[model samples]
Target: MSCWKYWPEIEEIAETLEGLGAENIDHIDELNKIDIEEVKKQLDRIEVIAHDKDIDFDSAKHILDNERMNKALKLIRKFYLYIGARLETENAQEIIDSDLDPDEILNKFHFYERYEGLLENESKLAKFNENKTFVFIGSGPLPLTLIMFRKKFGCKCIGIEIQPEVAELSRKIIDKLGLSDGIEIIVGDETTIEDLDYDILMVAAFAEPKERVFANVWERVTPKTPVLVRTYSGMRAILYAPLTDKQLRGFHKEIMLLPIGNTNNTSVLLRKIE
Candidate 1:
């Protein structure tokens, strides 16, 4: 959907994916029709350019700064999130149903492998035992991260979601899962991070305007507080926009762990610069 009219070279491609979206296309629909393979081919190319081992971060910025590719990535990102949202909402509802086995429904999720890696590696990435009140921004409608954190780590979590309806839905899911005591979903946004006294702060991959959010966090949080920002790179950036190191100027990046799975998020552990 980028530069269909302005750029003749990209016009044919943009016009092809003109209707790429969730309302028109279900997540379960075969992506082959959307030329996903072609899109992936381009992403693989970008992955090579951005992560050639010797290339500096500028390689990635080159892709992000490119107006044509960036626009297409953004459009595809929205479509991807829409599909994921629908699936998660459906799964949440299924868990809420008294007749359905929540375990059965959860077992169908493709993220078990990913979350298990997180469960095993979180301690190595960040300190969670010192204090357990963790606040997660952009927790979404299902709050799966909070659920997993509470269940696995015995930690308490507060989810701050910008959308009121989505936060309410997440609240329902937590209650239905009988985890109300360990997790709470509130209707708020990035700004909410400042008002809460949390042992740790986590920014989800979907949180918008990464630089602004991190700046706000830097200005508001106490000195030396732990911050974990979930980021994506390489082909993963086709879905979630990758964060540039420049965006995190006020934080000391302590440790980074890239998990291998569908969740393939790079967990960047940060501490506020004193």
Candidate 2:
């Protein structure tokens, strides 16, 4: 269910998409064909409605639960991800080709400030075992999450990246920071998980086809192992796909949802119940 209010605003955005010739908003291919800027404008308006003070939490949740609205939100999120990935790819290529310090590049990442706030939250920090190891899936060029986890928890970390160049660059950054002893950067995806041992699994925010990954993790990891799935909530839901109930089948029902700072990003904590 959605946690967003302002049905009128959402309806307007849906109408706009439909007007643009979107036969099925839930289809990613159709959404990708639409002009990104137009989609972004609609998303911006939806965000404003999400933050409106007059919209109560219960009402927003009810609107979000509507099937049609949910499909529209999913399409918007796909467009957002498409645009973001294109931009990120361009930026990563430029950074990799430049002589800029890795530290400086890491500092300039958009999510750096938000992550700092999240790392400082004691209640959320308590959820992880400080003495255990962690493996972060989809660890990108910077591996900031692994860096933060190591610094804050004093725990060992292993980052899995699909891109060889990104994995190499992340390793260089880790070595530059003298954190090589505490963290290891591996170049691969979920397949690499089998060769390593970790106490916790952290799913990166931009991880694609999360349902499949969650199922793979469930089958691979030991029972009761904690899995932290990072997802978007509230207004951010339009920019990132959140996990659906169908994808959570093998997990315990007693789940915990922790918001990261004041952002629409949240960490869904679950244990392998099967």
Candidate 3:
């Protein structure tokens, strides 16, 4: 019996890998056909198969490492972001309605504390100082990064949100927290950075078309300015696409920070080559 007959889930993932490698068509269409929850289930199965000594680990590893599988995984991550953006919109309201302190809510998410420590360590290595201006791309509805940066470092921060509803809600949250003076939430995209001045640039984890954003930043921002990119590697690859080796070639300085908690997500500090 063939693997497809015995292991349908594995075959489904294999088929997705083949499909991604065969075309350069609309990724959204391909993404629409996939169920994020289902994909996670398939990935979980693959992980188990890869570790099972009785199973063919080498064969499973080959399929997992296939170039096409990586591409398909990236598309799945895009789908995840698409779904997450909508969820975040609802979550923002939930946070607002809960009557909990915004700081307490942010701390519950662990990002505020994670970034606080990450930035502190980065400051020592990169000679970073407080009070610098920060512009966050794809700041989403919560703008946790902006709030954290301003609260922790006393930095001036601006958040660019492409979705009008998310931008409005994020502003409301910022205002409620009385951070309106320190953090500005603008309704815009990556292009918004072109007209603004900032000492540091932060790329959100869900930001798409990252290559284009990087190119735009290189063309518009000063070479001395540092860009902090939140990306996934290792097991987190299921949720986010990690920056590839080729992507790191453009930056003059690149430092990969330590992972936070159990999440496979990490930050990369980059500076444009002069």
Candidate 4:
């Protein structure tokens, strides 16, 4: 939460961990929640600010009890602390080897990325067909690509997001833009590979790297499913299903890169045949 109250503890912990010569770190994801060291670092700073301002537990508790001033201080700080504690730990190095929840981090990241702020009206939606079911591998800035596809092809879209926040945002954006009926956003990984019969699968390459881990996650289809993948720069060499092929493609003749606050030279669109 607020670095004002938790900074000292976090720093102490980080320093202690540092002294212990713990270098490697791992992520924690439970119930679509991410436990990250960065958030813990921020909490440590917040604790520092709290001490500098002479604010203590009682003061924070008081402010939190009030409704009016809660937004500026209490609410933000409290949630920050809650999230920080959930995602991070003092002795992460010792547990780094344990199973980490990648999906939790992905879902949270997805939720934030999708609905952090208002998207301009100029942003386009990906193309899809309602009559067909499609799997959206990644929900990045180019989610519009999927939206457009849904509108044109009548496809039912199952969008998988890495971050819970981004997934929430995507849901909000879909609801706000009146696209909810067509797209079903799921905040997690696709596990049932063999059972999925998606007519097509779409993904944003740059958004979800290290995709090799989930390479065969897609389920088996009858003959082949059309997978249209988009990449910002020149496409990296990635093998697809047997009958798939790559081609330079774009929607609305433009694609947005939200993180960089710009657009791309061209979106590398791939069409997977089998």
Using all chains and alpha carbons, the TM-scores for the candidates as numbered come to 0.75, 0.71, 0.70, 0.38
Candidate 4 per-residue C-alpha lDDT over 195-215 given as tens digits, one digit per residue, 9 for 90 to 100: 456766555543333344234
| Positional deviation of residue 204's Cα in model 2 after best superposition, in angstroms | 2.2
Instruction: State each model's C-alpha RMSD to the native.
Output: 6.3, 4.9, 6.6, 17.0
Candidate 3's TM-score reads: 0.70
> Across residues 1-274, which tens digit of lDDT does each residue of candidate 1 receive?
2212223423333344555422454444554245554554443343333334443344444445577676665655655555456657767777777567666676576455666676565656656652578888899877878887787678779999998988888888787778898898888778887678788888888787888888888888876677888887644555567788798887887888865544557788888887
Q: Rate the local accuracy (lDDT) of all candidates.
A: 0.68, 0.68, 0.64, 0.42
Candidate 1 backbone clash number: 0
**TM-score order of candidates, best first?**
1, 2, 3, 4
Give per-candidate clash totals.
0, 2, 0, 54
Residue pairs with backbone atoms closer than 3 Å in model 3 (clashes): none
Q: By summed lDDT, which 10 consecutive residues of candidate 4 come out lowest?
A: 234-243
Model 4 Cα displacement at 7 (Å)?
A: 42
Put down candidate 2 lDDT per residue, 1-274, tens digits, no spaces: 3344355666678678667656644565665567766866776676566555454446555665678677776655655555555444434455556577756765676556767765554226335556788888998876777888888778888999898977887777787767899999998887679889888887787876677877887788887677777665554555565677787778863455545444555666677875
Off by over 4 Å in 2: 1-47, 50-57, 61-72, 83-105, 120-130, 176-178, 253-255, 258-261
